[model samples]
Target chain A: MQKTFKIVDEDGIHARPATALVNTATKFKDTEVFAESGGKKVTLKSILGVLSLGLEPGDTLSLIAEGGQAAEALSALQEVMVKEGLGEVQE
Target chain B: MDKTALSKDILKLVGGEENIEQVTHCMTRLRFNLNDNKKADKAALQKTDGVMGVMINGGQFQVIIGNDVPVVYNELVKNMKGSPEGRVSSSSADAGDKKKKNVLSSILDFISGSFTPILPAITGAGMIKGIIALLVAAGWMGTTSSTYIILSAIGDGAFYFLPIILAVSAARKLGSNMYIAAAIGAAILHPTITTLLGAGEPVTFASLPVVAATYSSSVIPIIIAVWLASYVEKAVDKVTHASLKLIIVPTVTLLVIVPLTLIAVGPIGVIVGNGLTDGISWLFDNTGLFAGLLLGGTMSLLIITGMHYALIPIMIASIATLGYDYIIPIMMVANFAQAGATFGVFLKTKNSKLKPLALSTSVTALMGITEPAMYGVNMRFKKPFIGALIGGAVGGAFLSLFKVKAYVIGGLAGLSGIPMVIGATFVYSLIGFAIGIVVAAVATYIMGFEDEPEAAAAAVPAATADANASSSNSAVIADALEAETAPKVTEDIYSPITGEVKPLSEVNDPAFSEEIMGKGFAIQPSEGRVVSPVNGTVFSLSKSGHAIGLVSDNGAEMLIHIGIDTVKLKGLHFSPKVTAGTKVSVGDLLMEFDRVEIEKAGYSTITPVIITNIAEYSSIKPGGRSAVKEQELLYTVQA
Candidate 1:
C-alpha cells in the first residue's frame, strides 16, 4: 500500500518526529515500511536513514508498506505522523 | 599483527567489507557502523597487537588505535574495501549517537571550516594592501592616480565582497546550494537595497518593516543566512515534487530567507560586530597597558583554540570606522615574542634533532606565522611558552604606553608589516617588536627547560652506581679506571667504537633518519670493533651478526645496527662477541667486523645507536662532539 502525506509542521521530519516515526514502524512485524522524499527512498524504521532524507516543512512524504501486516503498518504510521504533528494524509 | 596487519585483520573479524555500512575516525578511534553486530569477534579484535582498545556504543563499533590510528585507517580504506581512488564514504550523521558534536567542537569546526578556504584569498589581498600602503607612503604612487585606483580596487575587492565569498564557501560547508546562498549575499549588497538603506528611508518588504543593516564587507551574517537556508531548502525539497523542486526550492528559500536575514541575521551580526569593536576600543582607551597585556599574553592561546578569528571582524570594523587599530600592533609583538622563545629553545636545547626545527620555526614566528614555532618549539617546552607570554605582555605594555597604531590591514604581524604602522607610531612599534623578542629570548634562556626525560632517567642509575662504587673501596675505583675511566654510575651511552659522533638525523636510512626507530646518535665507525654502549643484557642478536638489540637493567632499550642494509651481508665479514640473553657491560666487545671489507661490499659503515623505546621519554640529548674514544659519553636518554 502507498500513501502520500503532506508535512504540516513548521519543522518537518526532524529528530523528534523521526524518532517517533521509527518507533511506530518498529511496533509492527512482518511488514516493511519506507519513506520516499527528494527522489530518495529510506526505511522508515531507521532514524538515521529517515534523517538522511532531510525532510522539512511543506514537503511531501510517500509512505509505503509491504507484506502481511502492510495495511495495519501504513494506518499506524499515518496516525503517528498526524498525532506527532509531522504531516497530514492527502485525501 | 602489526598496525597494518591488525587493521587488515580487523576488517575480516568485523564481518568483512560487506558488513560495514559506514566507517569514520576521530582523533584516536576508528568508528564503524556494522550491518550485523553479532558477526564481529569483539574479543579477537581486542587482542590484536596494535589495537589499543575496543568499544561498542549506540550501534557502532569503535577500535581504538593510539597515534597511529590514521595510518591503520588509511590501510583499511585504501587496500581493503575502497575503490581505486581510495574514497571512503563518510556518513557521520547516520552513525547514530556516536557522532554527536558538542557546542565547543561545533563552533570550532564551524570557524575553522569557514575560514580555512578563504585564508589564501585574504592573505594575497592583504599582502597587496600592505604593498599599496607602502607605495603611497613612499610617494611612489598617488592614492588618486588611475593606476593606484585600479590596483587598490583589485586589492580591496576581496574585503569588500567578503560576504558574498563567505556565502559560497559557507553554503558548501553547511550542505546548501551555493548559488541560492550566494544570491542572498547578492541581495544584501544589491545597489537598490544599499541605496535605500544609505538614504535613511524607512523600508518595508511585504508590508513588514525592514531593519536597515549595511551587509557589505560582513562575515557572520552571511554564514548565518547560509546555515538557515540549508534547513529551508531541505524543508522545501521535502514538500515539492521532484519535477518542481529545481524552481520551488530556490524561490521559497529566497522569499523566506531574504526578509528573515534583513530583519534578523544582518541586524544581530551588526550589533555583535559593533559591540566587539566598541568594547575593545573602550578597553584600550581606559585600561591601557592592562588591556594590552591581557590581549598580547593570551593571543596565541586564542589562536590555539581558534577563538582568534572572532577578533578579525573587530579589526576590520575598527580600520573601517576609526582609521586605525591598536590590536594588530599588540598581536605583532605576541608573534615576535613566540619567535624569541623558539630562538631561546634553539640555543639551550641539547637535543640536536630539535635544533634545526627550532631555528626555522623561529624565523617564521618573527614573520607572524607562529604555528610552527608555537606547536613545534614553544609548546614542546612549557617554560619557553610561558616566557613568550611574559615577553609579549612586556612588549604590549610598552606599545600601549606609546599609543601605537596599525593604520592599514596587512598580511602578517611580521617585520614587513611595519609599512602599515605609518606616522609617529612606527618608531614605537619597532621598539615594541624588538623588546618583545629580546625579553622572550632572555626569559626563556634564564628559565631553562628539560627535553629528554629518558636521558635523565638513565643518569639516575649512573649516579647511584658512582656513589656505591666510591663508598665500596679503593679497589672499585681502580677497576673503574682500568675500564678506560668510564662513568660507572650513569645511564649515558658510551661510544662503542673510536669514531666521530653525529646526530641520528643525519643517518642515511629512514628507520634512523626520521628517528622512528628511536632518538639516538649515529657514528662513523673508524674502527672494526663494536662494543656494548650500555651496561645491559643482549635482548636479541640478529643471526647475521649485523644488528644487536640490548635492554638495560633500568629498562632502556637500545638498537644498534652496524651498517646500512648490512643484514644482506649474511655474516660474511661480521663476528658476534655476545649471544642473545648474555649480560654485557660498557666497553665490552659485542661484535667485530672488517670496516674496509664492508666498505668494499658497497655498504655505508655508519652505525645508528637508537633507543627503540623512545616514546617513553620526554627528550633524548644527542652527544654533540667531533670525535670520541671508546667508552666516551655518546648520548643521554632520560625518562
Candidate 2:
C-alpha cells in the first residue's frame, strides 16, 4: 500500500517527528514501511534513515508499506501523522 | 536503530561512563583511554548492534563503528559529557601509563601526538606542490606567471611556517601554553633573525654567540625550543602571581626561552639535524642499497613510534642543502608497500567487515594517509605488516640502485608524490613504486593472516535480525533482550545535588513521600548547583527548571525534582544548563538554583532524587553518605 502526503509541520520531519514516525511504523509486525522524498527513499522504521531524507515542509512524501498488514500499518501511520501534526493524507 | 540508544549500549558495555578516562575517534573507531581495561566487556561490545569489532592496542580500547562514527561519537559525547572531572585532562591519563613505556616509546608518543593533528596541513600543501609541479611540467603555467607564483607561494607557505605550526601542536601535546610556544617559534623565524642569518654575518645575543642557521622550514629547532619552553613556562608560572600570570608568565618565559633557543637549543638542534642528514647521506654514499633496505624495512616501525617525524627535518635539510632528498623516495616505497599489503588483505579476507575496511584503507594508503590502513588493517592482521616490510625492502634496494631521489618535498610517500621526483630518474622512481606495491601484495597473499572469525562479524546479521524481530519494540529493545538473556548487572546512581541526605518520607509532597512517583531518597541541598547523577541524555526538563529527568546508560530512568511545589516560581531563581536531549555525564553541571530565594518564596528545597522506573530494578541500596557531595554514590540499583 502506498499513499502520498504533503508535510504540514512547519519544521518538517526533523528529529522529533521522524522519531515518532519510526516508533509508529515499527509497531506493525512483518510490515516494512519506507518513506520516499526528493528521489531519496529510506526505511520509515529507522530514525537515521528517515532523517537522512531531509524532508521539509511542503515536500511531498510517499509512504510505502510492504507485507500482510501493509494497509492497516499505513492507516495507523496516517492517523499518527495527523495526531503528531506531521502531515495529512492527500484526498 | 537509534544512535542515542546505540551510544548508551556501547557506553554501558564499556563499563559505563565512569570507566572511561578519555575518548577520541579517528576515521572509523572510537578510541578510549579506559581507567580499568578489565572493566570493559569486550565480548559484549563485539556483539553490540552497531559496533563492528573491538580491539585493545596502543594503550587504547578501540571500538570500530565504520563511517557513521562522527554521529555516534557525538551521541557518545552527549551521553558522557566530559570525563568524570568535567575536564579533558589527557595528561593525567598519559602520566599513569608513562612509567610502563620505555623512553624511546614515550618520546615517539610525544612526537607522534604532536605531529598527528597537523598532518592535514602538511599533506594538503604537499599535494598543492605536486599539482604545481605537474602544471609546470606540462607547460600549462609558467614559473614567472602570477598564477604560478601565487600557487607556489600557497604550497610553500606551510613549509615556510613549519616551525610555528609544530610549536602549537607540540605545545598542546606537552600541555603548555600554545601561544607562548608560537611566540618562541615566531621569534626565531622573525624577518630580522632570518635576514641576519641570510647575511652570513655573526650575530650575538647578550655576548652569547648565536648560530646563523636557517630557522624557516626547520622542524627540530622549534620542537626542541617548545619542549624546553614547556618546562621554562612552568617554572616561570610557579613564581608568578595568579593575577599577573596572563601577562608575566608568557613574557618571562619568552624572554628566557627565545635567547636560550637562539644561542643554545637552536644551534644544538641544527647540529643534530645536520648530523642526521650527513649520516644518512654518508650511508647512501657508502652502503648504497643496504641503507635503503634498512630504512625502508624499518619505516613502518619508525612511523608507529613517530621516529618518522625526526626524519622529516633531515629530509627538508637535505633538500635545502644537498639539492635532493634520498629519504622521501625510500619512504614512498614503504607507503606503497603498505597499500599493496592492504589490497592483498582486501582480496583474501572473507570477513565482510574486514573486506570493505581493507579495500577503503588501501585506497586511502595509496593517497598517503596510511594510519588507517596501518593500524586498522595491516597491523591487525600481523602478516600484512611484515609483507609490506619485505616489499618495502626490495623496492628500496631497486630505487637505491637507480639513484632515484625526490627533487622537492611533495605529498606524503604515495602515488600523489610522483611529481616530486620529476627529474631525470622520475621513470625509475615510478617503476620502483610499482614494484613495491606488487611485491608487497604478492608477499601478503603468500603469507595469509588469521582472518576475523564468523562469530566476530556483528553488524550485518544483527541489522537483519533486528528488522525481522517483533515490531512492538521500544527504543532499547536490543538492550531489553540482552538484559533478559544476560546476567543481572548492578549500576550505581550518584547524588546530583550536594547536600544533607534525607529520607523520602521527610518530603512535604505526598507524591514523593508516599513513593507514588518511585522509591528513592531526598537531599536537603546546601549548594545551589545541580549536576547529572549518571552518564545519559537529559530525558526531560520541566519549563520551570524545578524537575529534570535522566535516563542512565543502563536504562535506569531518574527524576530529580528541586524543592516542594517550586514550579509555581515559573523558572525564577532557577537556571538550567542543559535542555531536553542534552547528553550529560556525572558531575556535569545541569542546573543552578537559589536556595535562599526558594525558601523566602515559601518553598521547602528538599530535592527528591527518585528512580522513576524502580520496578525494573530488583534492589536499591543507599550509599550511606549523609553529608553528601555531588557525584557521591547515593543509591545502587541492581537490575
Candidate 3:
C-alpha cells in the first residue's frame, strides 16, 4: 500500500517531523515502511534515513508499506504527516 | 567533548595551569610554553578524546585540536588563576632556553619571527601589483585610466606606508608598544619631514643636521628605527610612576626616539641599505652568471637556516632605489627547481602514501610556497635536493646571462609572476622559468633515490597495537582482529572542499565538538567552494545558506556546515548553487561563497563535514593527513 503526501511546513521534514514519521513507522512492527522522494527511497523507521531526504516545502513524498497491515500503516503515517502540519495527503 | 571539559582535561594532563608559562594557538594547534616540559604528560594527552596528536617542538608543547583551538584556548584562560590574562611573565622562564640558543640562531629567530606575521599583507599587495602590470601590458587597461590609477594606489599603498606596518610587527616581536613604534615610523614619513627633505636644502633638528634621504618605501630605516624605539620605550617605562605611566611613557618615548632617528639613526640606516644594494649590484654586474648560480644553488640552504628573511630588506631596498630587482628572479628559479624535483618524485615513487603528498606539495611550490616541497619531499630524498641545486644553478646562470630583471615585486615567484618582468628580456625570463622546471624534473628522475620500504608502512599499525596493549584495551584488540578477519562492509566519504582536513572534535561548536550531531571531519578551506561528496539528493539547506544536508544513494546521511556561526551573516557573501531536493552527483557544485569577504567580516571559514547517520556505522576513520583536495577520500565508514 502507498500514499503520496505534499510537504507544507516552512522548514520541511526537519528533525521533529522526521522523528514523528519514524515513530509512526515503528508502531507497525509487522510492516516494512519506506519514504520515497525524487526517486530516492529510505527506510521510514530510521530518523536519519528519513531526515536525509531533505524534503522541502511543496515537495511530494510517497510512503510505502509492505505487510498484512500495510494499508493501516500508511494511513497512520499519512494522519501524522497532516496532523503535524508537515504535509497534506494527496487526493 | 565540549570546550570546557576538553580544556579541563588538557590542563590536567599538562600538569595544570601552573605549568603553563605562556599559551598561543594557530589555526589547528594549541602551543604552550611550559615551565618544565617533563611535567606535561605527552602520552596521556595523545590519548585524550579531543586531541588528534601531541608534539613537542622548539621547547613548546603543541596540542593538535583541529579548528576549535581558539575556543579551547579561551576556556583554558578562564580556568587558570595565576594569570588572569592567561599569560605569565616569560622573562624568567625563557632564560634557560635563551642560554641554549647561539647568537646566530637567536638573531635568525628574531628576524623570521618579526617578518612572518605581516607576510600575508605584503603578498596580497604584491600580487595585485603583478596582476595590474599584466593587464596594462596586455593593453586591456590603459595606463592613464581612472581604474588604473585607483588600482595602482591600492597596490602601491602597502609599500609606500610599509614602515608603519613593519613597526607594528617588529614591536610585537620586541615586546614593545606597537602604537608608539608606529608613531615613530609616521614621524619620519610625515609630510613636513618629506617636504624638508625634498627642498634640496639642509635640514636641522634641535641644532643637529638631519639627513635629506627619503624614507618612503625604504625597509632597513624603519626596522632599525623600531628596534631603537623599543629600547627607548622600555627605558622610559622604568622611571615613570604607575599613576602617570599612561601619559608619560609614550610622550617621552616619541620625544626621544623621533629626533634621534631624524638626526642620526635614519641616515646610518640609509647608508647601510645603499651599501647592501651596491654590494648585490656589484656581484651581479661584475660576475653575473657565477653570482646567480651561487645564490640560486644555496637559496634552499638559506631558507632552512632562516637566513632568507635577512635578505628581504635588501630586496626591498633594491626595488625602492634601483627600480628593478635581480634577487627575485633568482629566487623564482630556485622555487621552480624545487617544485620540479618534487613532481619528479611524485612520478617515480612507488609508495602510494608518498605520491599524493609529493604531488600536492609540488603544486604549492609552483605557486611560490616551497616550504612543504622542500622539507616534505626534496630533503627527504637526498638526490632530489641535489637535482634542485643543479637545476637552479643552470636556470640562474641562463637568466643572469641575459640580465633579466623583475620590474615589480610580484608575490608569487612562479609562472603566474612572469608578468612581473617587463623589459626586452621578458621572453628570456619565461625561458629561464621553464628550464628550471624541465632540468630539475629530468635530473631527479634519472638520479633516483631509494624508495620507502613496505615495512615502514606496516609499522604504523603495529605502533597503534602496542599502544593499545600498554593500555590493556583487550576489547579494542578483539574488535581490530574481527575487523581484519570479518567480511567488512565499508563506504568511502570524499572531501567536499579543497583544504586542510582536521578532526571534528576541533570544531568550536559543542554540537560538533562533542559529536552530539554526528561524527565527522572539519576543513580549513583554501577557496570559497563546496561540492557534493556523493551521488546524492539534497536533503535540506538552512535558510541562511550556511549549511546543507545530503543523502547518498547508498543511505549515507551527511551535513556540511560552512564556517562557524556563519548563519549570523544573513546569507550575505553566500550563494546557494543548488536548492534542496535537487539531485547532485559527486563533484557537482553545491555552493559558492566569497571567502575573502566573509573572512574580512570576521568569520572563520573552517567547514565541518559530519555523517549524521553515524549510528548506522561501526567505525569512521579519517585520512591521516592535513592537506586534502576536493573529491579525495576523506573518511572510510565500516559497517
Candidate 4:
C-alpha cells in the first residue's frame, strides 16, 4: 500500500516528526515502511535515513508499506503524519 | 588536552559525527563503532595529527591515541555528545559477535589493557630510577643521602605501589568502579597486612587461613583482583535496588571481595607470577647465551604483535622478588639495535623521504621509543631489520655471558635506561650498548638492503645495455657472450597519461618527431596528472619538471616528457614530485600538470615516453589503439 502526502508544516519532517514516524512504524511487526522524496527512498524506521531525505515544506512524499500488515502500517503512519501536522494526506 | 580541532578533524576523517555509532577509549586508543565503515577515510585518519595508528579490529574502527587517550577521548565524547560509560564491556560484547580470539591476541589484549593506563607513571618512575642510578654511579649522590632518599621514594614509589595503579586501570578495562577495585588493592598492601606478614604471625580471614604474600610491586595480583571485582560489582548492582545502590553496592562488594582476595586471588596470583619469573630464570640459567640471543632478537617482533606486554609480569616479579632481572638488560640491547638499524638506513637509503625519517626515528629510538624506527625504517627494509636482530643477539649474548643484570627497571626502550644496568659490573652494560649499536649499523651498511629492487634492476641493464653499447663500439665478442647467456625477452610499457595516443612523428615538435630524444609514442593527454607506467625506481627526474626517467625492475629504461617546448616555460604549468631515486609501481601518481596552462603557454601537451636504451631492443612497436587510458599497454619492446 502506498499514499502521497504534501508537507504542510513549515519545519518539514524534522527530528520530532521523524522520530514520531519511526516510533509509529516500529510498532508494527513484519512490515517494511519506507518514505521516498525527490526520487530517494529510505526506511521510515531509521531516523537518519528519513532526515537524509531533506524534505521541506510543499515537498511531496510517498509513504510505502509492504507485507501482510502493509495497509494497517501505512494507515497508522498516515494518521500520525496528519495528527502531528507534518503533512496532509492525499490518498 | 584542549584539542577541539583534532577531535573535530578525527570525526571528519571517520565519516563525520553521524556515522559514529559510539566512541569509547581504552588506554591508547579510541574505539569507534561506525554506521558505515565504507564512508571512513582511512588514509586521512592515519595522516591526521595525534592519531598514532588506525585499525579495524573485530568490527570496531580503532584509533590509537597513545598516552593522552583519556584527554582526547574526553574531547571526542564532548564533541559528539556521547557517553563514555560501559565502553569496554560493550565493545568486548561487540567483539564476541565474531570468532573467538586465538590464545595470542587474548593474552596481548589482557596485558595491554591492564598496563597501558599506568604507562605514564611507570615510564616516568623508570626514567627517574635510571637518572638516580647514573647519579649514584657518577659519585654525585650518596646512596643514603636525604636528596637521594627523597628521589628514590619518588622513583621507586610507582613500582612499589603498582597494585593500586594497576587496580585503577584494570578495573576500567574490566568494567568496574576503579575506587572499589583500588580499595581492594590497598587492603592487600595495608600496613596491618604488611606488619602481620613481617611479624611471621598466622592470620585468618573469617576463620579461613590468609595467604602471606607480599603485594608490593606486584603485577598479577591487582589485575586478578580487579578482574574479579568487576564480576562481584556487577552481581551487587544487579541485586541492589536503585534507592540503596550507592551505599549497598560498594559495601557488599568490599565485604565479599576483600576476604576472597586474601585467601584465593593473592595466593593464586603469587603462584602465577613466581612461575613466570622462575620459568624465565630457568631459561637464562640453563641456556645462558642462547637464551639471551633468542629473547633479544625476538623482542621487537613481540612488540609488533603486542605480546611484549606479557613479559612485564616476569620483569616486575624478578625485580621485586629477586632484586635484579637479566631481561631488562637484554631488552636494552634490543632497543639500541633498532636505533642502530635506523642510523644505518639513514646513511644507506637513497630515498629522499626515508632518509629524514630514518635520521629522526634513530634519535627517538636512542631515547627509548623504537616504534618510529621499527615501523618507519628498519622493518620497511628487511635486511636492516635482520642486521638489527643479529646485532641484538650478539650484544645480548655478551651481556648474558658476563652475567649482566639491571638493578632498576628503566624507561621505554631507549638509552635513558642505560644507567639502570648498574649491577656488579656496569662496564658490561657499556660494552653491550656499544657493540649492539656499532654491529647493527655496520651490518646494515654492509648488507645494503635499502633498495634491492633498484640493485636488481641495475644488474640486468648493466649487462644488456653495456653489451649493446660495447657491440656498437666494435666489441662484438663480449656482446655475443652476453647474448649467449641471456635470452631476448618482450616487456609491456603502459601509458602514463590518459589521452589520444599519437606516433612520435605526428607530434608537432621536430626534436621529438626527428627522434632526437630517442624513439617512443606521444599522447595528447586529457588528464593533468602523470603516473608511473612501470614498476621501478626513478633514476633521473629533470629539475625542469617536464621529464621523468625510470628504470623497471626488469631493466626497461623509459623517459616521460610532459609537453613539447614545455621545459622552456620554466615549470610554470607543472608541479612534480621529482625525488630522483623514488621507488614507484605501475599506476603510482608521479605528478600533476596544468594541461590548460601548458596549452595556453603556447606548448602542445602531447606527452611522450621513450625507451632511451632503444638499441638494446630488437624492435619497439605501438601496443594498441590511438586512444589510451592510464595503465593501458602503449608500447611493447622485444629484446
Best DockQ among the predictions, by candidate number: 3
Better of 1 and 3 by lDDT: 3
Runs of candidate 3 exceeding 4 Å displacement: A1-91, B1-95, B131-150, B321-323, B346-364, B367-369, B407-427, B451-639
lDDT of 1 by residue, A1-91 (tens): 9999999866555434665787567656568999998798978766445655656678889999998789988988888888878899987
Please provide, for model 2 over B503-600, each residue's C-alpha lDDT reduced to its tens digit, 9 standing for 90 to 100.
Answer: 67689876677565665789999999999999988866766777787877887777788998776677799999998779999999999999999999
**Interface RMSD (Å), each candidate?**
25.2, 14.8, 13.1, 26.9
Write model 3 residue lDDT over B1-639, tens digit each, in one string.
889999999999887777776566644567676766546766577677777556543344667675577799889878887642234444463344334334665565455545655665666676677778779888999999999999988877877887888888777766688899999889999988889998989888778898887888777788888888888888888988899999999998899888888888888888888889989888888896888889888876665554676887777667656767888888899989999999989888998767887898799788775655775678757898888988898888888877878766635677666666766678988898788888898899999988766444443455453343222222221112123222335578888999887666677876666565666789999988899988889877766687888888888888888988786676798999998789999899999999999889999888888876664554465454356788987776655
Question: Once superposed on the true structure, which residue ranges of model 2 sit more than 4 Å away at CA?
Answer: A1-91, B1-99, B281-287, B301-325, B335-387, B405-426, B441-639
**DockQ: the better of candidates 2 and 3:** 3
CAPRI rating of model 2: incorrect
Score residue B589 of candidate 4 by CA lDDT.
Answer: 90
Which ranges in model 4 have alpha carbons more than 4 Å from their true place?
A: A1-91, B1-40, B49-103, B123-156, B197-204, B285-287, B346-357, B417-419, B422-425, B450-639
Query: What DockQ does predicted model 1 obtain?
Result: 0.01
lDDT of 1: 0.72
What's the distance in Å from true for residue B439, model 4?
2.5
B202-266: candidate 1 lDDT, tens digit per residue: 88888888888887777778888889998999999999999999999999999999899998888
Instruction: Compute DockQ for each candidate against the true complex.
Output: 0.01, 0.01, 0.07, 0.02
Comparing 2 and 3 on TM-score, the stronger one: 3
* TM-score of each predicted structure versus truth: 0.52, 0.52, 0.53, 0.57
